[model samples]
Target: MSHIEIFDSRYARLKAVDWDFTDASQDSLASIHPYPARFIPDIPRELISGLGCDKGAVILDPFCGSGTTLLEAQRAGFESVGIDLNPIACLISSVKTKELPPEFLPVAHDVYEQAKNTFDGYVDIPTIPNLDHWFKPDVQKALSSLLTHIDEQSDVNLKNALKLALSSIIVRVSNQESDTRYAAIDNNYTANDVLESFLTACNKIHEAKKRNSVNLECSKIFNQDILSVLASDFDKPVGLVITSPPYPNAYEYWLYHKFRMWWLGFDPIQVRTFEIGARPHYQKKNGQTEEDFRKQMSSVFDLLSDVLLSGGHVCFVVGRSVIKGKIVDNAELIRNVAENHKMVLVANIEREIAATKKSFNLKYGKIKTENILIFRKD
Candidate 1:
């Protein structure tokens, strides 16, 4: 079939599905951590199944927030690679995709019990800026103790899972209202809530891992910016690239997850420096512009062109951005940029954002719809 016919067939299959996923259940490993503006798992699942890739082909999600695409790729029996600048994001993605041994659950419980026993004596709190504003005194001590215990685990996978469980409960145990809201509120979380919440998160994560376990050797995650990625990073040519690059000035992932990173011993400052589409990056003075975003995307396309196999596809799910009271068509911008890098836009499908899933601030205006742009390497 001609490329046009191939595009039409794929587009039809994609357009038939309910992209909204309003009633869909998101209670899987994808929900193990709270992330800003996470696209539903169905997006990647559908793309992986519908995009006509061979089984075991490598799938890439350069902006894999919490391993949504990586997990879906593994479910569909494919090798996957995920990259993100945020260390916490990398940690969550790695933990979610890695296979846990049969002994993981027992080890996890023992770790929890030991943490509780050693809680009172633990005191290795790292200095975090404005920590008092976000975490209460008692909460800080509780978290510090949990971290000390998590750090003592010798098994890499088990330690990472424990740390993730701890990270998952940080926001809930702090003054932060929710994942989307950065402002502090009068939350009643106490020191007593830390270990209980951690255990609950750990149990849920273990169950989620059991439900969707895949071969650990098939998946890889990188903790760095997409712009810095080289073709040499992948062992094989990627057959499909699925990602949702951050919207311009819509979400500051670094700011919202700074405490979690600090708790996990990662430098949030590093993430802030490299984070693309961050609110701080678009400030009026010494700030990046839409042109800069395009340039960055152009580089991503160029990398995709280099790494993707001939005739491979790249699907980008992006939302419109309201800048200076004008709706910026990010899809078109991506289309134009991708085309310049030897990629051809095949389909542009729009899906309405579910009201409950709209997580950005009202000041930027509501992003009602997201555009799924599919492009093929020529």
Candidate 2:
């Protein structure tokens, strides 16, 4: 199965696409990112695609951030399972994989009309006492009405699909620009217009899928820690293991997503406990100092070793960040830990991801390029 050697790809040297995805502009409804590197726990699917895609084969993404790795695996025709600390991530993944019933859109449209009409005379939604700061009153009311009606539906799949739709809208409907803090609305407001965000997300989902002619494959997202779930025995061996772990000096998955976490069914407080590189933890502790990060990554690697199958592969993509006037060479030195675990480095892919202006003033302030390290078990 060529399991002995690390597979190579054009993306290894040049940041090239390894698989086929229709143009984002062509698929107007899709939530495809302008920046591919934004994907958390990413797998180079185009590179992995060259490995092979056999039906019934399975794949696992331990750090499956919003399902990018899982989606690619499924697109490659393999059954896949994903786990993430963020509930919004799990929701996004789950909704993306579900193959909406043919009648879903038409039916949902009817519900949309009902929601709009219900808003026609009401003028305002119930005052969400805590939410006025983030959204206009009219927007909040429009959202609640849709959420209430969507909940009234008896069908579970439809309900989830509807929820997924709603979840997708959080970015556009709010003062939140990107998934970053600067892109957010005034936090002083306690109530977020969750219901409105949900309906907008639902509409986006239907539109995105329709544009792609995508038949989303079956997959499941667990809103739990990968470490806790790894002990469970699976019925099949995952043919591929594609995921990117948290990078040192980067974002805290929870805080970067705290607002989203609070709006969804998840509790932001609980999510904060598990998120890596959280700003609070970063500042409170030693920060991403060389010694601290090395120690932390080593343990995480060991935990990962326990989950991977014999001879299976683990690909980690990371970037160097300036922390206190020094560069954190995550990919270079990480091999030190890999060797300790008896893992071999197959390849190192270099690339870049967007960074903020403040990032530039730091020790590694340049919009630093990242690396994709492919490790295979001996």
Query: Model 2: per-residue lDDT, tens digit, 287-368?
Result: 4466766776677566657656666666765666656657667777777888788887776655444343111112223534
- Native-vs-model 2 lDDT? 0.58
**Which candidate wins on lDDT?**
1
TM-score of each: 0.91, 0.75
Error (Å) of candidate 1 at residue 350 is 1.5
Model 1 ranges off by over 4 Å:
1-12, 185-187, 215-218, 357-363
TM-score of 2: 0.75
The global C-alpha lDDT for each of the candidates, from Candidate 1 onward, is 0.80, 0.58
